[model samples]
Target chain A: MTSTETTPFREAPIQPGDLLLSIENLHACVEENEILRGVSLQIRAGEIHALMGRNGSGKSTLSKVVAGHPAYTVTAGSIHYRGQDLLGLAPEDRARSGVFLGFQYPVEIPGVSNLEFLRVSCNARRQHRGQEELDTFAFEDHVRETMAIVQMDPAFLERSVNEGFSGGEKKRNEVLQMALLEPLVAILDETDSGLDIDALRIVANGVKKLALPTTATLLITHYQRLLDAITPDFVHVMAAGRILRTGDKDLAMALEQRGYDWIEEADGSDTLQP
Target chain B: MSNVTQSRPRLWLETLLQVLAQWSGGGAAGQPAGARDWGLPTRRSEAWRFTDLRCLTQLDPTRLHTGTAAPHWPEAFRQAPSGQVSPRRLSLQLDGRGHWLSPQGEPPPWPHGLMPLPTGDIAPGQVLRTVIPSGTLLPLGAQLNGVTPGPSLGLQVSGPDPVHLDLAIQAEHAQAWLAPHVLLVLQPGARLCLNWHVAATAQAAVLPMVEARLGLGAQLEEATMAWGCPGAAFLGGSFIHQSPRSVYRRTNATWGWGLSRDEPFVRQSQGQAETHLHGLAVARGQSLLDTHSTVYFDGPAGRLRQRHQALADDRGHSVFNGRVVVPRVAQQTDASQLSRNLLLSTKARIDTKPQLEIVADDVQCTHGATVSCLQADELFYLQSRGIGRDQASRLLQRGFCEEILQRLPQSALLWPSLQSLLETPVPDQP
Candidate 1:
């Protein structure tokens, strides 16, 4: 309910009911190379799950699969979000249904201003909930407020979306959108990869601020530093296209202190029980 | 000759001969020499090659309404924000035959140094025809201006002194044909801002011919928007002649009509003149739009920058042909042109040709054109934030057209109206 909800940090495996997302034996690929192989996970309403894996371990693939990236094909899997088949819906439909993805490499759209984009997106979300759309004046105020969470410069609002922006600025822009949309499930796919120390703190703080009791987050990252900034309830180590082990935040520290080799050696997963 | 029904090309030749006859003052007694004749364009002619006028053949010219009644100009043209170099507007309306209507109340006092050329009518700004030069044997749409039979009045701003002149043209009449000629002459050091808002309301045809001559050190900044109602068509040619040290900049856009063709020609006869042009042509709903522009440098040390954009959705088709010529005598000339086209639907089409003809060894010229659809990733990016695909497309479309819209002077910016127009749905397919 608060920014410091990770306090009294409990080590609990995912539970049933109040289930925000359920991925059962998800298998996906791009071209002919299979990236996600029989990956299964579940996230509750008030949970922050961290997915860590080695290069080509399918952490990013799982995030994209959930976001409905057109590039990846699901050979066999069922993704249920809010009790509906998420895979049957288009990416935009998935988004309108309260799903958000903070891309690992956020796209640059030239000529579309950041402010205009935010207003359009926010108004769309509002309209879906049967609320009236905000005029330019009202939208400007709303966006200016949200932009402060990411410490984004107001001038960036006039600039083209992510065009000519630094890596830190793009990440901040992603968090800014997250704050504006306030989605039910937010996937930060390698959002910390190119960010510096200052940017990482601001982004992590913004995410922490936006997390609500009814909202869930999935952070796909390789470092334990991001976990240290915004503590996760569950940390899963993935290897060879499948999540090998699931544990508390200590798992991230363990994977960082040692390596993913230990998680791979401890084979035949689905070890953690509710 | 009046009873003859000739082929379209033959008719154009006949019209040109008649114009020559009129210039020689050889018209029959009791007949006006300046009877504007609009010859329909056809595929055989070079100027009308890309734009087909076969559609006009079905409409009977004899049945055209030459109604003397004037229209109540809509509020679109009256939107000029206060306080930044204010200038007077010239309210003029013309019939299909290039004739201005009877006195529509007292006209605005002509700005100093702008003398109206002799015409049968006493109105101001209604006679839009520019006098096409009979001097050159070069190919001419000069006949288009010559054929519009109207009370001829020319507005010329001369430059033995400096003058700040603003001219605006807008149409609102229904079911009338328009063949008007507009002429402007700016002397050295003279400055002019011209705006043309051409609209053909419902089943009307508007063909305008504008000719402008700029002396040394003269400057002209012009903005134009050509739009029309269903079944309305507009076709025209604009010729600009510049002397040494003259500067010309124009920003033009077409929201589009059923059949529209705009031909603009710029000739830099003397050295040191600068030419800049920005254009947007949007076609939708079975509309056909073609813009052919040529900028020629006759003397050395001239510069030019030209950018044109086209957007077509549904069964709409848009064509752009831009040519820049730098001759042997025009050494040290610098010219660059770009054409950007956007097609929103599988059925929409765009044909663009950006060319540079450089003969001088010391000249520099470059041209490029690109056709692209809205990126799916970009669309997904906007939608991920909860924006609909349609709204996101409109935002991107506005963003695309703004590149040219930004070139308009701050004093002439029509913000609210343009903003509302951009927000309106753009028909993606017929």
Candidate 2:
């Protein structure tokens, strides 16, 4: 239950011709501190990229910044999703554009039932896409089925969103939301944190099932164990808010055994450019 | 009936003096004659700190000389008197002094030992006397109505079986000052469920009070709602006296009154009593709503849980004051009071205070007050899910109010207009 056999989730050639998200020379700040400095990455349709970084390496901030979080001001950067200026769009617009970021710590909304929130949220997305909104009963069946993908209990749907939920349950709930939203570019931030073996399996498998050939996935984690469950086509190591190296899945296993010192030394040896 | 009656004879306007003196019945024993000698409430009055009497006086300047007028039913009330005009289901309408009737023009089937009679036959009982006391505006308004010979109705309950009553109060025109009072006496082991809907449409002043006494081992569940718009002013209060082994539960909701206040006072006589009070006030436009509740534990082993919530937008103002008193004899008392408020607009204001006075050595009393605007992060959380900023705020606001609304009686929850109360768009927080 600890790890799955490394069956490369994306063995076909990466669809570089259909770029979905591209980050070039990105820099972001929260309040007084600069968090994401000169971070650049690109993803194409039908590709899965695993981002491995140490604590405080700015992985979470990069995820939030790309999601158009207002709190994280992109001082000097450019994010393009589907060939459009993503940073210029409002957070909600980005969501409707099919980009979803699974938070490391989902907020607790007291007195708001999970079912109602999800239904309203889905309706908003559907309306944005020029589709008819789903009513309560119709949305209930869809949400119930989606919850099963994450192995969530039906009773959790009746409770407040993330309120009083265990850490693992909250993670699984986030996965359920991702499955329901059906985002084109999904960024899973620390989805492996605070999860048991069974929960990890359910969440990883849920992500794998929801990802379509036209959609891309970004898996951000500190450990390579999650990579085993959902093998990525490419693994990128990040430090000081910038990705220092990129390789195949073995890079994740190598970083686990060799630690981050070798990557730091290698990055210092080269003249890094945005 | 044991309301406020202590007066110090301070020189005041004749209108204030006449109203207080007549209402206090020439100063009852232990009643605060200050109720009379004291002039009309200003911001200086502790109980009236959050409300302005000028607003009420402005509604009817010559109220002192005019007195209560004859019950002139409005066209709206005279019709089939449908729910829109007074939409509460299973309702009894109070047309005038000492008169009560069902919207369908009949009375409810009262359980075994309870009977309904004219207001004249029912001498107002003194149980909730300590709750409202004779000295407040409630007694003054009631006494003013007594001046006019009008119709009134009273319901008497004496059986051990459960009794249920659904009633409503509708005030007359804007020029006349209206005051209506009702009494309920529960016998030992009796159970009573009473729901009241109070509405005033015209530009008049109103003071409505309900006084109830719970006998030993008796249980009572009561829910009352008072709503109005720019033209009306209402001062609603409830007083209760609970005997040992008795329990009292009350839920009060107010919305859109020009100036209104909901006050509750309850006292446990011999301990072992339980009391639950839940209040919600939603105000918009230039409305002002305030709620002040005080619960006292007199004997040993009493318990209380009280919560008050306010949601204000536009240029509205809301106030909440919850006070819990535990005397030395009331050992092993458990009490908690929380006042949660949401200021939804730049001009919206909220004043919340939770006061606890415990003289008992062995008691658990906790009180807290919170006034907050919706967090930016919370809004972003919803907006990030594709909901617009405005829609996201509405969801959060509805969720904030759902805590108490979910606990209200089914009939009140189903009130046709209640949905709009939660649906109104809130201005973004400044």
Candidate 3:
């Protein structure tokens, strides 16, 4: 209703492949306004994809819709994870089945201890994976070992979850959860947005260490600085709720050098008026 | 409408008056109980407006049990797993008639720094009466206590060492209506930590009034956990008088009562004292819980911090009215009151009023109230972590209660009833 783009666009037909996640001709909305008009993407195991877009480019909406955020309504879309219809599952079921969305702005839950939340979350995923649940003592040992990956202080475990955390500290906590839950498809939505130089390096390194051949990572960000630390196999430029171009990491560097307006100029339209 | 239908409260009041008269010879020497201004609180009373007393009035008054019965201490109080006594804590129980007994059913001797008040000192109810204004009507619980010939306890806490006392008050029989009064006097430089864990049977009433006076350089930390059954009501009152340089901290967690009301009033008599009041109510089912708290800074340089929280689910209702008064003489007084409430269902209700009446120019007073459902984002955050929606909601509710529950006494923190408060149906369990 606000912009020019209203029709759905399918880039190509899905071919038979061992893809971990496949999103074909996705259209989603929040409230009554459509955010993702028609977007298609594909990710295979062991690949790290970087989704580059400017503000209001539907990057975050894509991540939330993939994770089954209740607020976003998928009007027309088909999402398949491991050949299973992903949209049919609840958010928790998706999470338990190894889909993780690292929120851009992690919610702060007051009075919920960070350690307890982490253990419960980890246990939920473990149970789904046919693993025994860790009791409080065992979980502490496992979590302490995992905390070293994010360089998080043990004091944070005693505090309310993200209640008074600084921006960098909160991002680190998101990565900590990623390590604990061990999701197959980790959507890091702007996980490096508010980090400093040192924190960005630490977080990028953590993500790099966690990326295994059996898992896939979708790094949603605007800048190429994060890619500099953890090289993405492919970088896709998203505009007008659709992927405008897909290329290697060089595209991210080019966009970083020229800014996002360069992508609009190449596309020959000012369609990113969100 | 049938005559009995419209006269249920009237009949209950009439029977209550007769019972009080029979218990107290007559009211005030030949004055009839009905003429002595004894009646159940009506909606006309602002303090009782949001609280429905139907849970109390609907009970059959002819079977109201007033006799003392030995308390059956919950499993938590049974000798600990180690079967060892805690040297730092002295445990006691109050029977239906208010007699102090050990966990094994015998009266225990007062500890070193604690002793029973002399027989000639001020009576148990005298201190509470003085705490009220001259013309103000006494609370219904205090008035009933005045006319009922129940046992009372008065303790004088002194000496340098701190005293830790755990008291359990239980109405173990159905239809038992208990009216017990306690007076605590802390001398200068004295310290006491008192924990009260209370439970009541079905169709019963547990009305307890506690009056305390803290001298200069003294400290009193009091915590209470009250769990009530269906058709039961808990009307508790606490009046504390603190002298300068004294500190008084009171934390209370009450739930499961069909109708529960707590009125705690504190007066920093000469100010320069510190008072901390914390309360939590987990109201579910058709239960109603209300807390009316007031702290008065009568002189200069007083400090007060109070927080009250409630969780209402099903059709339960929770009400809180907190008032902090800083008069002109109480300059430089610093006080803050916060009332936080949660409504878990569409039919559940919560009413909170944090009132600060500051007449002093240089004083700093802040008050706030919030009533809301659990945060949607918080629940989603938990759910996205693979916790089920129901488990996530329960976790958030438990998190909400942990803030106040952690402040309870050690014994109360371990009580199974308090632990299961969020899990079980309130009307069915204590």
Highest TM-score: give the candidate number: 3
Give the runs in model 2 whose Cα sits over 4 Å from its true position. A1-17, A268-274, B1-38, B61-90, B96-98, B111-114, B117-122, B130-153, B156-162, B171-173, B424-430
Compose the digit string of candidate 3's lDDT tens values, residues B273-362: 999999999999888999988898999999999999999999999999998888899999999889999998999999998878889999
CAPRI level of candidate 1: acceptable
TM-score between candidate 3 and the true structure? 0.91
* Residue B60 miss distance in model 2 (angstroms): 2.3
- lDDT, residue B8, candidate 2: 21
TM-score of chain A of each: 0.91, 0.91, 0.90
Considering the two chains of model 3, state its CAPRI-style docking category: acceptable
DockQ of each: 0.32, 0.31, 0.34
Off by over 4 Å in 3: A1-17, A268-274, B1-11, B24-35, B67-77, B80-87, B424-430
Q: By the TM-score metric, which is better: model 1 or model 2? A: 2
lDDT of 3 by residue, A1-274 (tens): 0111112222122333348899999999999989998889888888899998888999999999998888999999799997888998878877887899998999988777898899888887877776777888999999999999989999999998998999999999999999999988899999999899999999999999999888899999977789999998888888889888788888888887888787776772422210
Q: Is candidate 2 or candidate 3 better by TM-score?
A: 3
Task: State the TM-score for model 2.
Answer: 0.85
